[model samples]
Target: MAETNKPTATKGVLSIAMIKKLIGAVVGIILGVYIAGIGVPEGLTTKAMWGMAVFICAIVWWIAEVFPDYVTALLMCSAWAVFDIVPFGTAFGGFSNATIWLLIGAFGMAAAVGKCGLLTRISLYLMNLFPLTFKGQTLALMVTGTLMTPLIPSGSAKIAVLAPFAAAVSDSMGYKKKTQGAGGIFAAMFLSLGCIHPLFLSGSFMCYSVVGLLPKDIQSQVTWTSWFINALPWGITVLVLGYLAILFLYKPEEEKRLASTMIKDQRAALGPMSKNEKYVSVVLVLTLLIWMTEVLHGINATIIAIAALAALLGYNVIDRNTFKSGIAWDAIMFIGCIFAVSGVFSALKITGWIGKVLGPHVAPLLAGNIYLFLAVLCIVIYLVRFVLASQLAVITIFTLLLTPLALKEGISPWIMGFTSFVAINVWILMYQNAQYLVAFFGAAGGEMVNHRQMIKLCVAYMIISIIGLLVSIPFWKLTGLIQ
Candidate 1:
């Protein structure tokens, strides 16, 4: 047994994935430098060149999954400080942004709602009211998602609250996991979560963050009321179209009865509403009233959210520990990083530079045909979303880049902001969003959904989106959002 010597295995240094990421980082840095050097545009400055390099590297790391998104964000801030691209205070300034605090407050409120079983109780009550037909069941789920949007700013939280109910509904109907009924239910919830965010100012943290990024002059016009008025038509249109698409794509076999009593039983099991639930409900209603009446009160939405969160704690609906644990710190960090990056881009004048480079090329094409330009832009945004992972990230980056171009084309900033927000989230091709993926898998439970079925549903939704954009042009014109 001893005659032949065993060959010694080599101890590896970097794994293949790590090596690829390193190459990606290096290439990204080099590309950024090349862009800086070649950017002989009129408005661009030397500081923007360095900022571009850091921005590119950060994006590469984000796309490669080389590091966590927040970690990449932190690295970008650090790089900006280290390279003298911006001051340390400026780089980390996003942490202090009121929008970040707004998210924390909204998340805390959502946590309290979940903790008190308000979400489940409401969901069950809604399910009880809907007709027993398959379409009725789907509508119930969609309605639940829509109603939850104004309360729960976190999409993932809404999914968390609804996925179990959806599963239970499907199970009660004798539909197995991945069956048509189950898939349809999941799609309905998912699509509702996706489409309803832009409809309300408090519906998504991304909306607030976009507003924060706008210039002070334009910020006044991007109010909660304006956003709702401008975006409601498109949002409702997409919701209806998406619901129909899901039904068409995932037609559940005829289930003669939906077992309405199952949801009723669940509601009964929750017993009477607790005192805490009542308090939280009151607080939520008050918060929503304030949010919706921003025009009358003129109070900032962020302040209203914080005030509601404080009321929750004051009334013991949620304690300090609950509030602390409930807040999604990672999401806060990610949002902070996005705000920081946008701030640095503005400070470094990179946003201006982008306008200079693309203005001439895009200006002529957009001349005398703004709607045609917008239609094309909408399509381009959808295509670009394939590479990005986070809807928030997509909105932050593209909104920053494209807003200038839209402004140069003589479009209203409010219109640009609303359109960009909608375009960023119209993810109809794949479940790129983490929240959507969580909802998908959660609803699937043991039986995973068929990928092909999901794709078909997504394709139908995409077509609806395209048509919705075109049809909404007349509406936007009538509202004077687009002229």
Candidate 2:
């Protein structure tokens, strides 16, 4: 209905999207010029003030949705080098960063898995292991998504692979659009895929990006095994609590069993694994094993991932087209640009100045009490998400401001960084989570589940995420992350 009612474009009349772009453009340019005109403040360099202006403009354009995120990122990166805020190599240095390569390699592996029908086959096998009841189906989806997390690092990629299966399951069960059963299946899949990302370094590019934002010394310590160990308790708590929330909020009208024929039939339809599937499975397993054993081998994670990509290409498991289309180049550009932006921010001493200015005001609430600090931090991040469209922005800003204080209080900066990542990832609105939007509109086809029911799941996630973080304090203590 909303789509049908959208006003058509006409000469001399602008659409809402166009109006947003215009306003964003005008506001961004004006602010950038005005800020640049201001004299550099005490204790901050001239380049830092200009960097702030450019960063602010880019952020405004991003929140306004003026252009694709990658485009905005491109503009920011170009601005830094053009304005001499940083050297050209420094401004564009993220392109050569190891973290960027890791993401590129991960996306390629995901593409191979997705293209070979392995992801779909695995999903069906997982779902078919359970009963055909509504509760059983929803639980199956949650479990499948969790299990798939390690194999597929990108949440959007996972949703792309699983959401269609979820919709098919909903239809097979006689559930219609906006129906409780259908909504439950989607809620379980989307939320479960989202919440478990922090548990593994390869779980999502967001995890890798956040870790990249940390200091170099801290980055070396946060390998795959240590990340899982640190995040296991919190990740498990959120997954269980979130599943319970879905079951509670989207109860089915009846408990009758549905047909399992569709699931079993689909699994059988594949007949046998092709050579590509076998090759992809081998490469994926070997890559994961190498990643997990990084402590002993002492090889960088990026090298292993690049090697996996090479193996896939060498074996012809994925062709040149797959190499081009399979990787999320836009995400790669966006993340790389963000890294450059953050580098400039750090070099300009902007973060230290922010800490100095805001530290005193935030010190009391955050002082000496790790629990209180976390609680307050979570609440602030929750509110910030309402306006900040980019999760990376939220993570970067909060980490810069609060990490110094956290370290001063005998807390690891990883705790602060990881908590902020988790808090910002939980969303109660459609627009807040881009990955969820992709799942809803792409996999679910914007029909299998409706916004009203999904909102209930989102609210549940919001509350449960906070509870999960709070519950993990004891575990963090045991790990010696807190004094």
Candidate 3:
């Protein structure tokens, strides 16, 4: 009867299709105009305009939906070859860069840790450090995340790995999810915080790309030592403050149960790390050592990652299908697309137009008011994710187009780039922006935290963002060697 009673509005059906078509058409038109310009002898093929349009759309698509980010990035690289925007060799150069290898190695290590449940062990071990109040676990988990972020670049994978521990805590506290007001909201917010760790690393994908755009002379100033100087302290400040705000405001329902015995139960299921995980760890550790000591010992990270991924399959740590399940190939494809599109920015002279458009307010926007500028940039980008829907899209659009303009005004593009990431991670306000939100549902049989609760948590997080930015930005400049 309920199935029969379902509304059958033909208009609703029509409207949904229309919305997608309308939006898609606009995207196509924008891409078309830019690509069309590539043919204009003087105006076209300059790589600035056309490459960027594809770059923009691909980023949007990857973020808005479940398409590939890596593929999009690679596509931008491909555009360089197709349009002769840059030497095909130079365009492919980025793929082989040490920073790219760092991403691959770090993620591979994370994957091994996740597969063998090392992260869970670490997570549970950390949980044991606190009083085991639900809040204690939440705070501990968040601290762990902040500690982990500089090392781990894939936010979604990190949160996915962390979710089980959070669930275990929720269960340990004896508070049923959803029935307890905002309990799951604590879960969501903590996950957001944990996912935020990569902001410090020059190796994080967005960080690397943004850093790549900096003037060559300024590049040497950012090394691993310098980036962490700023990021670690700032990340700690935000985590500490965020924990306080969340613990008090989103307090878990007082449980009659005690945690004195919970660790014993958790230990029951905790076994020795699996063999594959150990292999992954070894491979990743060895890889990172090579990457960090590039001056004395240079090893390619991508090759190492690909080799490890292949070796994992051969060794049966993960079978082919399982490996496929683990990697988001679509995202890889999307990254390629973005690379191809970014090529047009160089090909068509579009960047100049974008720069001029943003020129007037450049100085005043960032003129000696760094904190305010970054704060506003974060809030704006965070909100824009509602419509934009992809983290990569936000980076591609804002970083590529607006960066030169901000630089012209004496603003450090690096700082501006950092702000884009700070804003992007605060995706708690809207369901549309975060993969972690979706994971909570899958992990919990379709049950989810309330949107209103998320709103409250995100609102409080606005303050936390400022704290994070303040701690990290100057630290980057001071310590001066994190890239």
Task: Choose the strongest candidate by TM-score.
Answer: 2
Model 1: which residue pairs collide? none
Q: Considering lDDT, where higher is better, how would the candidates rank from best to worst?
A: 2, 1, 3
- Candidate 3 — what's its lDDT? 0.54
Tens digits of per-residue lDDT, candidate 2, 1-483, equal 666555544422666668989999889988987887888877798888888888778867876778976798799889999989988887887687776777667667777777788877766676568877878888888887787787555566456546666776676677877888788888887877766778787788778888888789889888889999888888888888887888888888766574577777777888899999999999988877776555567777688778998999999888999888666666567767766755676677775565465556665676756677777878777876654545776787777677777778777889888988988875564446666655665444467887777877776777777787788889888888877
In candidate 2, which residue pairs get closer than 3 Å at backbone N, Cα or C atoms, i.e. clash?
none
Instruction: Please give the CA lDDT of all the candidate structures.
Output: 0.68, 0.75, 0.54
- For candidate 3, the 10 contiguous residues with the lowest summed lDDT are 334-343
Consecutive 10-residue window with the lowest summed lDDT within model 1: 4-13
Query: What does candidate 1 score on TM?
Result: 0.68
The residue ranges of model 1 lying beyond 4 angstroms of the native Cα positions read 1-40, 131-138, 144-236, 248-258, 367-371, 380-421, 424-463, 473-483
What value does the lDDT take at residue 222 in candidate 3? 73
Counted clashes in each candidate structure: 0, 0, 71
